[model samples]
Target: MRKYSIIFIFIAFVCHFVTGQNKQLLYDFSEIPQSLLINPGTETDFQWYSGVPILSGISLQAGSSGISVNDLFANDGIDFNDKVRDRLINGMSPKDDLSGTYQIELINIGYRGAETDNFYSFGIYNEGDAIGYWFKDYAKLGFEGNADNLNNRFNLSHLKTRGEILNVFHFGVTKEIDNKLTFGVRGKLYSGIIDFTSTKNKGYFVTTEGQNNLLSNTLSADLELKSSGIITLDHVIDGDSSAGDMIKRGFFGGDLGLGVDLGFTYHLNEQTLITGSLLDLGFLYHSTDVLSYTLKGNATVEGVEIILPDAINDPNTDFWQDLVDDVEGLVPFEENRKSYITFRPTKLYGSLRYNFGETVQSKGRLDCDCNLSGGKSNRTKYANGVGGQLYVINRPRGPQAALSAFYQRRFGNIMAVKTTYTIDKYSFSNVGLGLNLQAGPINMYFMADNLLAYRNIAASNYASFQLGINIISWGKN
Candidate 1:
């Protein structure tokens, strides 16, 4: 039973994060109020905007690199066991990951500061992100008892995972330096609700021929799992805790941290613009309700070597127990209450767009709407724009990047449409579409990614969508 503990933990850890934080559809989508969340420097034409409370902004993205549900449970006639054996235990690699991210805005509102001529934006939102790398070697060792395969070292380092849920309160000031440059900076306060990580584990287990016994099992293991706010969350789940307390924990009654975001937009020429933003460049400090599991050191056991006075034929189980106890002492599993710091998964977004076609008339005005200051110039709003965008996020394995090219079209001042084709590690043929509509002072926008995969979502690797509604004032007479 002691020998099975290592592999059991690995099998459990492989179970789960999803589509990541690549919001290509909403990166530079100035039509939606939430685009500011991704790029605070996003050019805003509205004089002021207020989201529709909790219903204002919502986003979710989920995906896996190695296998989809259809691979195992498709209607095809392959045997279920065989599919699992081939697709899961055999075909998957260490780099393959299942990860996801989600966000819900609670309060989003912005206004133009009259004194400084700067746009001020602030909001609070709940976010959760998780990622887990597939444990290939451990799955193989568990599925196929390592009796036949000698000298094959099953890596303990294949286990890498992290997850967190927190709320962020942020305020930003976007300033247009000149007609050619616009920049913004946002400060963030993080209230962590729950978090866990087991990303930097290292070691291995190998079975080799022994001189005194038929086999020698050796394990070189260094592993640790750190968690914060899990105890309270567990209590809440078991009905032993109040929901209000949990919400309080999510609102700075628990752990706390700080972060900042920076973004900028630069117009190289009248028809060209370069834009980018860096998000979540900060860390969380967790001290309360922290629990950690650690398994370190090394141990080796050659079968169950035991000797008794009754003779070798009838061995005392206590002697075997003694051997197990000795081995366990050499490599102990421990529980600890220690503080930790977890860095937020940082993301980068950049794009270069070309504006063209006819210049649209300003809302209710063919001439300049107001005085030209704060980077508001006589520059025209083109009816068509084309661009390519790049999105990258720091992952446990490495930085993953996606590239997309889009075409945007505007219909007068009432509606806008954008279509994109993106290529990433998950899919090469992912396509996205977005729409922004305006009816008087009401603003609504929707963006969907991997639209082609909608035909059979289960077969696709990644898909996501974002939508929001807000009231806006352009300050036009």
Candidate 2:
């Protein structure tokens, strides 16, 4: 009963958090400094900005393309076993997944270079990303024993998962090469803290008729799980080591890697523009505190032949013990301290935007505004904007994509709002909204998606939230 309860809890967690990595509401909103993290080439009008420590850039996103909490746990007055059978074991597919991403900026600062008229920014942040695909056949077999499921091949390849926690230190530069083209690039160093993965698995389990016995069971399996840094971290959590020990395992003190983000904004005319970016093209090598496991082989077993008279005389024969030993010899399970490498889940983003309404300049602004970037295009900051954006991220199974159309309104530098309608694998009517407000030198912003589900977070198939505070200056006008 306790094991069943734990299974139910795991089911609920996956239903609530399985989702893609998409932030359409904040992608191209130049009013928020975090947008630069997604598109470094995003056009900017600010002179300099600094985030409010850890509070400046905090975000969490979770969702699923399958069942919600209401399907099993809702007060629909249905039998719990029936719900599990119909909704999960029967309805869910192996392709359905559980996933989520979260990020927190530790220090972010950006300033325009007085000598080069370029924008130079640098920051450090902690990020976590994870994903696990559903295993329908495995779940079905576990719920209903094979005694009732003969000749059914239960897939062992359905189990797939990978998760990691790491710190990223980055530096970027945005330069306007010409009036029509502005481009940027960010270099990154990744320091991994904890990681685990087991994606490539194969084989199956089947029970079939036997000539000599009542049944013959066969199992074939090829599976592996890999990890790094979890051993010492567990010790720290158990009070055997200081927290600083784990901190040292992060921030360039652990498994290290390199990557980069490239982006550009191209002006079609004056009001129409196109933008695109590619992020996290890097890989990590896990050599320290590494551990991995593997199970690979095939086995078949049949109960001992019980001749009516002989079985009555040999009741002490250990048939089950013999079967276990035979299976263990056929399918060997082993563990090793071997190192491996993992590539970062690269992401792609692109957008087309059209600016409208009259230019609205507020506060300290030069009459022409060209002085800001040493011939930075005197393009106007329109009061309104409409755009379409597409996002894609690499996953263990494949690439997941999302499309969005948005409308933005701004009241000079005081306040700005962006609303979006997005369509993705999880939800079609996903509405996202964001607000950015600037009061004197203080800047703050908040963004969220799946507003329809905000009324019932538990019943939601997808949800996301982001907020931050920062300080800014337009330079001494």
Candidate 3:
């Protein structure tokens, strides 16, 4: 009976081996930015003058300058989770029950200056940036009962994930010719870290003695006993056991790029103006560290014992060990992997506005404005979507009652923020309040999209944020 159980167990293992296929390598390039499309002009006091670049200005300005910093962080973290889920789920192992999450933290500081005299404007600046993401996953499986007769069956699995991080540094200059014709260029430095791991386990059992009793009890029992022998044959001999495997890898990379921003602002009338710009035309490169892993496992069989060789049992064996040992190893140790980071081409922006009742009284005059912008990016395998925003703002000549209203459309990983407001009897003229904050030569702000974490799917809720600073040549006063 034990012998038969062992045979059955071996067969099951072989079947498991032959039928299992590597999980499809789901590569989610969603993080890849959409084309740089026309985006609404939104800047904060600190950002507008600070001369720093922004990922998306309109949305960040909508959050109200100086809202709880915690809120800004919370919104961004939630949005990242939502955007990454679509890619994470596909890469998950079938045997793994995954559960783990990660969040990103960013900090940026820099200076920028721009010099503009009628026809030409040139600028220069430097910035420092840092960001991170973390997540964890736990995967497991278990089985109980006699290995030979298969009296009972049970299974359990779980996955937990943490976070990963990346950092960036940039220093460059931009140039613009005439208020009507503008050109710019910049250089960037990239650095980051990625660490991921997965683990799995399986358990089962078999029976041997019960078959002998069945054969003696009834005529039909003999036939059952014969079948039992074939099943319990392996289990009766090997006994209960457990096995598991895990792999982990870590790497880093860098990138660089050059872009141009051509914008034109024309006066429609004494109280109105229109402006637009084509932004972000450049390329970036990244280099990642070589990754390696060690694997080890143990399992118990019922009928016959199958032992792994000592070499295979050692978990200390590095993944690169084999390649290093190769007789004619030209590449001693894999140094790194290179990739081109292409800028999404959808960053184009345009806007129309009418300003009325200029500041004539001690309390500044009121200004009302509305604006919209949208963009999209396409990669080798997937296409990113687009979004737009509309907003209005009202401010007293002084710092007193500054109010605004906004509405935005965020699809996939994109986000928009629109606003509107009313003040004093004289309804202010066009005043779209899409501005970033600037302190001295530094500009910084935060943004988010896809507020909810939805995996393997695109939702209007996905969000993202950017806080940046740059130095530009301010037009001669």
Candidate 4:
């Protein structure tokens, strides 16, 4: 079990097998239209809508909290390198993490804006994300090899992380500032088809007490690794480009960014309601095909002062290239293509609903399908409602939250349903389900989330799903 202890047990088993904006069944499930992508001031009486482009929408999510993978390579034989050195000397830390997300929607549409209480939307989507953690002193100095932890110290600032894959073009607007507030906003344009990052790492790695190698090691560093639109391990071993020109240069020449999203919904009375949102708030801007790597220097060592080469007609005795050119002359390694900046992993949502049975009123055409006088409309809803929500995100071992409780139903103008129950940090038996269907102007929906791990999804830590389809219109108000 050595090769840098199998690369630190493959990075602590890829940080518990690299795996949620807690969009509990599409948040307020307002007869699903992607629930206005999570509250675009919800409340749409639809006058137009469309989606069905790339099959409308789709989403996926995965999760990990603490650990999994059959609780670490389950073979039950025990001793997988002493359970990875006793789970790196007693089960992980540094806030144990691993996160995930994904989304797709090639184009979505909406309308009804010529001031009729306004509404409008636009879309294009693609997303992928990740988060990481568990850098407990580099897995306890790679499973105890700082020559017996001489002076302790091992930290390189718990090494942070970042990940991405993107493309998004958006537009939105929602307004209705009278009978109890409503507002929405959105704007985005990003297209950064791939990225990798590592943020703020600093020094440490110790061992001391030497003199003819009893022990003496040091390596203070400041690391960095950033990338964008990857591809270049010397162009993947010289195959010189083709993968549809790296997918048309990662979906149209990578690297670009900008973003925004904001929302609201209020009404303190008339059956209570309140909402909130904030998403992406973004950035990205890794200059085209960029790559960077750095490892600032500081070094010391006691053994291996270069001396080897026994019997082998030595062609200039290259003893492991003179101990890697004497550790690159005291720890130096840098590579650059520069240009970097990434952000966008921002999320937050809020909710509170209450609206009870009975109160459906939109048989709008007020006055027997009026055509000559007396017209007024816009007041329809209430087959049931009940809610609670709160989700937060922004992590690197900070700010993560979730809490949910829901129940919604509607059966008069098509069909609708929503159900939920959540408690974050990965499972309290998640639950969640949603469905919406409308027949006349078409519109479809489906949702899922940790439904009791679908009865044992290998001891599920988390799961999610979403689906969509649309074409809607309504207004005789």
Candidate 5:
């Protein structure tokens, strides 16, 4: 029975490693919307029409909270039923209700050419999180008269995850040929630490005579128990540990991209001007670590009764190694195994903006803008999604300061108020709703990722924020 359990663990681990490389399939539903956030051209109209020299600004943006994988797995509570456990343990078909959270932060700063109003910008972005967990159950087969029904039951719990703390530094320049055409190119250098952990927990159990009598007989009879049959098996082996120690090694990689923007004002409109740009053409190199394990079980026939042990493997020394080899067929072990995963970041976007009351307004002006964007990866296993943002900007100046009001929508659902105040070279932008607020420079902004602490108040309740800045010295011409 113990050997059988070891074999099962080994197979499960292999399957996990293979499937993780296909993250696009697992995360296909969470793709970023290109129009709303990635493409700068989509929202270019919001920028000042009379371009300022040294268009240097820093913008920092981040989410409100982080989520854990355990939260998702424990959402509905643990199910002991055999059928349900099997479906979860084995790679079942994809389902939508898989719950988790994702958060990202970006900071950018750049310079706009005074002569040609050509611009060069640079920025850094970091994203990370704990996604979710999955649970599965396995049963041992015993011959008739075998008394140890306990050792025959093994429950396996596993977690599927990938996370990275990455810093992407990018340099881009745009050349404006005329009011109608602009060309741009960008180069990015990515460096960061990636940590991936995969774990499997195996527990052995024996059926007790009182409430678990059914489980006892089921295992002793060597019957092919259905999924629900293991619900009452008494737990014997509590084997929980973390595998795949190679995650400590972090690697580096890079990519390149180009973009363009166009603006125009019709002759019919001395008062109206239309503007838009094509944004984002880039790719990222992702380095990942692969970890594997296996669990197996063995059984022997006795008299009319069945006897199962309380423990599955020896706790003293090489038990884990022995168990793994028994199931995996003696493969060579290496401390460092690496694979590179690659994908295009997302596509650029274009938008049109119409300005009103150019004749009536001198310093203060009103503009209405709509932008659309979408992201599709070269890898089909990855997810795809679209997004849009609509906003009205009102610019007015006071004796000591300049003020602008904005309403922006994101992810097709979330909406917020954006306000900016400028005092000379420094501009502060603030966006938020309810308890969360983000405030910072034109190029950089700070935000509290989550306002409502879901579970642990001390850790989850507090507001987490980020800061960013952009510095561009030349490139207007």
Candidate 6:
């Protein structure tokens, strides 16, 4: 029974913190208001814009690496247990991981402020994100128990994971300084719907020589699980405890936190440009309905030491119960309802671009919207542009990076399109598309990523998409 502790730990970590999907398509495509979410400093030409309520911004992404659902459960006559074992040992490593994110806008709107060169944007969105690495040692232990691997030190430090579902209310301002550089800053208020995180775990399990029994087992553990908005929902769906109640808490009653985003766009020359941003520098304080489980003890067991004097063979003998009680006394576990702080996953994005082909002129500063503030003398519009983008997202397994080369084509000022090819941890065949269309005072846009995998999504390790509509009014100065 003592050996079953690992099962609980595995279930807790694996059940949450699946990696979030990459948002490479919408990061720097400044034609739409959603781009402001990634870089608050992004420039906009609209006099004022309001999203179409819930339909204004919608995005969904899902991805998992190292292994997929078909690899282990397919009906190809391969043994399921053997397939998993082989993949764990040969197909994956400690660095391989699974991750993705889900997000949707509840409200969004933006407009030029009273200041001539200032723009203001604000919105509310719900998001869920998670990240976790492959636990190699735990996998080996489950597949090939200690009965065969004697003297092997199975490590517990490999367990690392964090995840959260929350609502973000954000407000930002983008200001143009002179005509060549623009900077923006955004502040975010987070209301946690649910959260769980486990880090700094340390311990090991090993089998050694014993005096009476053939083998002795030892375990040293120092593990902690901090979670909020989970334990209190044990009876969420029963009686009057409905999902609406949870949502109410998520909107204003749950744990709260604050974060900020900083970004800038600079024009090196008339045809050259560069831009960058840092996001999510904040932490959440989980105090409401918080619960922490802790295990900190070391013990070695060498079988049941007590022997029954008479009726040892009786079915009602309490010898085994006594042994179990002794083991629990040595390694004690505790639970507390204490608060904790969890940091937001940070992200960085940067890009460099050059304009070529035919260029369009701008009438005034309000009309000089271009990638990285690059445009003609008044406002230059080019027929074609090429650039490269770099992105880094911090994860429990460490920081992961993606590099992309993109091409943009503009058909007058009414329509524009951008295409990108990216290489990241999940796949090398990632292709993304973005399109923006303006009809008078109305604007619409759509984006999709991982084009190749759409043919057979089940086999693909990544996929994401976004679309939105808004009404805009341009200034004529």
Q: What's the lDDT for all of these models?
A: 0.84, 0.83, 0.25, 0.73, 0.27, 0.77
Expressed as tens digits, the lDDT of each residue in 1-477 for candidate 5 is 874475345333322221101011011011111111232222121122211222211122211112223333444555644433343334332111121222233544444445434555555444332222332223122212235545444333322332333345555555544433344455655443333333323333334443323433212111110111011111212232122111122124221222222222111122222333322233334333223233334322221222245233433445456545543342222233343332322222222223232121111111212111111100111011212222211111111112222222222112122222111111132222211111221222233323343344333311233222222121221
Candidate 4 per-residue lDDT over residues 240-279, each given as its tens digit: 7655555554465778889888888876866678888888
Per-residue lDDT of candidate 1, residues 272-381 (tens digit): 99999999999999987998999998988887665455556765457677787887788889999989999999999999999889887666212353323324554567
Query: What value of lDDT does candidate 4 attain over all alpha carbons?
Result: 0.73
Clashing pairs in 4: none
Model 3 misplacement above 4 A: 1-274, 277-280, 290-346, 357-477
TM-score of each: 0.92, 0.91, 0.29, 0.38, 0.37, 0.88
Top candidate (lDDT) = 1
RMSD of each: 4.1, 3.9, 21.3, 16.5, 17.1, 4.7
lDDT, candidate 3, at 277: 45
- Tell me how far the alpha carbon of residue 139 in candidate 4 is from the true structure, in angstroms, after superposition: 7.0
lDDT of 2 by residue, 1-477 (tens): 564455335434533352336889888898788888898897676688999999999998886666778788998899999998998888888888767878889999998887544788899998878787888888988899799889999999998888777899999998877777889899999999877788899999999998678799889999998988767666665668778876886776778888999999988877888999999989889888887899899988786555678778888877778677777888988889888999898999999999888676744322254422335555567789999999999988899899999999998879999999999877898999999999999999999999987787777778888999999887774
**Candidate number with greatest TM-score:** 1
* Residue-pair clashes, model 6: 11
The window of 10 residues in a row where model 4 has the poorest summed lDDT is: 364-373
By TM-score, how accurate is candidate 5?
Answer: 0.37
